[model samples]
Target: MSAAAGTGAKRPARRGIVLALALAALVVAVFVGANAHLVYVAVTSQPDCVPHAKEVGIDGAPLRAARSAC
Candidate 1:
């Protein structure tokens, strides 16, 4: 009877651990899927950091600053 009680207690503990792990996996999957599109864009597309690549002294920061000044 004592051994049966020990086994029963362990079953719930083991189930709880498994449930926690499964929940964590689910959350991770959702987070990754949500960001997958942005990840693909960043990886596959070349970021237009420099607006005028040929023009000397032209930077994105200046353009962004000019736009925000409005």
Candidate 2:
């Protein structure tokens, strides 16, 4: 009687642990999938170099630049 009750209680606890693990795995899979898509885009996409400010001989000033891959 008591042993059966103890076993029954353990089943729900085990189920809860399994459910939590499955949820965690789902979240991890989604994150990895999205990052994988972003990496694929970055590797396969190319952009034309439009005209931009290429100022040089300036001290501590930032300038926009693009690769000459038109």
Candidate 3:
């Protein structure tokens, strides 16, 4: 019947739209997850002020061995 044929065609279009939306959501989730990990590392990581063995008199050298509060 004509109605059955129209409904069948619309079903495929609706499925395609749903599939596209799911794929887009998956991409967005992956991107957000990666950025979240980077943010966490940046927040939780601490900087270390290591003394250079050879280059002692550098302009920005630390006066003493100390841990940075980065």
Candidate 4:
């Protein structure tokens, strides 16, 4: 008999590989969806600029920069 016919070992199963690919795709989809939602919210929401403390903090820095003098 030829050497090719002498071996009886079975080929490896692909179920695990398919399952792992599905899980990776699911994670990527969720990540992209979340980022898209965040971008949408940022673009849609526009609150008027509010007042900020004019004095510097103890650290000698503004609490936060005022977008406008409003």
Candidate 5:
């Protein structure tokens, strides 16, 4: 009887482990999906990932050299 009860007690622990693994898999899927979306947007929306020199600079001054990166 005690042996049967011990096995029954382990069932909930096994369920908890399965639930944790499923939750972890869900989180990983979300992260991968988000990263894929970001990559898609980056690749599809740009002629160049690097911006134009004028866009990078302000009023003919190099932006980063003139100002501290905030």
Candidate 6:
């Protein structure tokens, strides 16, 4: 009877440890997924640049700045 009680207590403790580890793994997976999405957006998106018409030189000449594929 004492041995059976000890085994039952150990089973619950083992289950608790397994649950904690699974929760930790889920948190890590979510964190990694969010970071990956952010990286993808940063890589795929383009930056906005000032248009050529908006810029003018001091000598009244139109400044042809480097154009971007906006």
| Candidate 4 minimal-lDDT segment of 10 residues | 4-13
**Candidates' lDDT values, in order?**
0.73, 0.82, 0.80, 0.73, 0.77, 0.83
**Candidate 2, which ten residues in sequence have the lowest lDDT sum?**
52-61
Over 1-70, each residue of candidate 6 has an lDDT whose tens digit, in order, gives: 9999999999999999999999999999999999999999999987776445535574475665555454
Global Cα RMSD, each model: 7.8, 4.3, 4.8, 6.2, 7.3, 4.1
Shift in Å, residue 63, candidate 2: 6.4
Ranking by TM-score: 2, 3, 6, 5, 1, 4
Error of 1 at 66 (Å): 11
- Displacement of the residue 30 alpha carbon in candidate 3, Å: 0.6
Query: Order of all candidates by lDDT, from best down to worst?
Result: 6, 2, 3, 5, 1, 4
What TM-score does candidate 2 reach?
0.74
lDDT of 3 by residue, 1-70 (tens): 9999999999999999999999999999999999999999999987775545334456666453343433
Task: Please tell me which model should have the higher lDDT, number 3 or number 5.
Answer: 3
Comparing 1 and 3 on lDDT, the stronger one: 3
Say which prediction, candidate 1 or candidate 2, comes out ahead on TM-score.
2
Total backbone clashes of model 4?
0
Task: State residue 66's C-alpha deviation in candidate 6, in Å.
Answer: 9.1
Residue lDDT tens for model 2, 1-70? 9999999999999999999999999999999999999999999988766755556435544665544553
As a whole number from 0 to 100, the lDDT of residue 40 in candidate 3 is: 100
lDDT per residue for candidate 4 within 3-61, as digits (tens), equals 65544322233566788899999999999999999999999988887656565684565
